[model samples]
Target: MARYDVPAENHDRVLELLRQLAEASRAEPGNLAFDIFEDIDDPTRIVLLERYVSRDAFAAHRETDHFRDLVLGQIVPLLTSRTVEQLDAEDQ
Candidate 1:
């Protein structure tokens, strides 16, 4: 899971960028899921539930142009704070 606190003043722009990022990530090979959600009480609080088939897949995702350029380069500047966690089930 990934959570982000983005600028409330630029809410729409931030949301748009996140949506674009989600779309691109979902289309990546080995991505099992990429879902986005927002806090009803606080629009600035965003959550992304991302899943990949394996650790290598996640690593490949981090190396992608869109992740580097759009997410790290573009979105990080718009965020006030962010947290990310990588998880896997025992079955994996």
Candidate 2:
């Protein structure tokens, strides 16, 4: 999971980019699920949820051009703050 706090100036762009990323991520070979959510109370806050078949699949996602070139290179710079964590599902 990941949480993004985008300043007002970058909110729209960040949200658009996240949605684009979510769409592209869903097409990845080992992706199980990809979701994006907006905070009800904070318009500038966004969250992402992702699941992969395995750690290798997740790593493959990070290595993709879309992930590396677009998300990391473009979108990341627009955020004021970001927090990401890896979680293990209770059962799969």
Candidate 3:
């Protein structure tokens, strides 16, 4: 699984975008899970957790038009700062 640490000020707008993004991912072949979490300490901070069946599935997801649009178009412009972490059970 991977976690995207995203920060944005446009609360309602960002949530709207997230709703769309979540809906879009649900139809993808490799998407095992897709979920979003809002940080308790900071309202602006959002975490996106993505899970896939395999590396190939992850690659396939990146090629999808919705993914492209979300990364290149919507997220980049909306986020103030973002960081992605590949989470592992051992890390905890």
Candidate 4:
């Protein structure tokens, strides 16, 4: 999961970039899911839920062109803050 606090002035652009990122990420062979959500109380606050086949797949995702360009190059600079967390599902 990832959370981003975007500046009010850059909200629209950030959202656009995120949409593009989601589309590209979901197309990756290693990606299982990619979802985006906005805070109702704070539109500038955004959350991303990403699921990959493995940790290696997640790492590869960060290295993808869309991730580097849209996320690192574009969206990151527009945010005031960002946080990421990694979680593993327990075996049933």
Best by TM-score: 4
lDDT tens digits, residue span 1-92, model 4? 99999989999999888899999999999999999999999998999999999999999999999999999899988999999999885658
Q: How many pairs in model 1 have backbone atoms within 3 A of each other, for residues 3 or more apart or on separate chains, i.e. clashes?
A: 0
Q: Is candidate 3 or candidate 4 better by TM-score?
A: 4
- Judge candidate 1 at residue 44 and give its lDDT: 88
Report the lDDT tens digits of candidate 1 across residue range 1-92. 88999878877887888789889999999898889899999998999899999989999999999999888988888899999998884563
How many backbone clashes can be found in candidate 2?
A: 0
Q: Residue-wise lDDT of candidate 3 within 1-92, one digit each (tens)?
A: 43334555576677787778888987898887888888798777777888777778877887989878976678757777667665432424
Residues 1-38 of candidate 2 have per-residue lDDT tens digits of 98988898988888788878888899999999999888
Clashing pairs in 4: none
* Candidate 1: segments with Cα more than 4 A from true spot: 90-92
TM-score for predicted model 4 compared with the true structure: 0.94
lDDT of 1 at 69: 88
lDDT of 2 at 54: 89
lDDT of each: 0.89, 0.88, 0.73, 0.93
Q: Please report the TM-score between candidate 1 and the true structure.
A: 0.91
Alpha carbon deviation, residue 3, candidate 4 (Å): 0.5
How do these models rank on TM-score, best leading?
4, 2, 1, 3
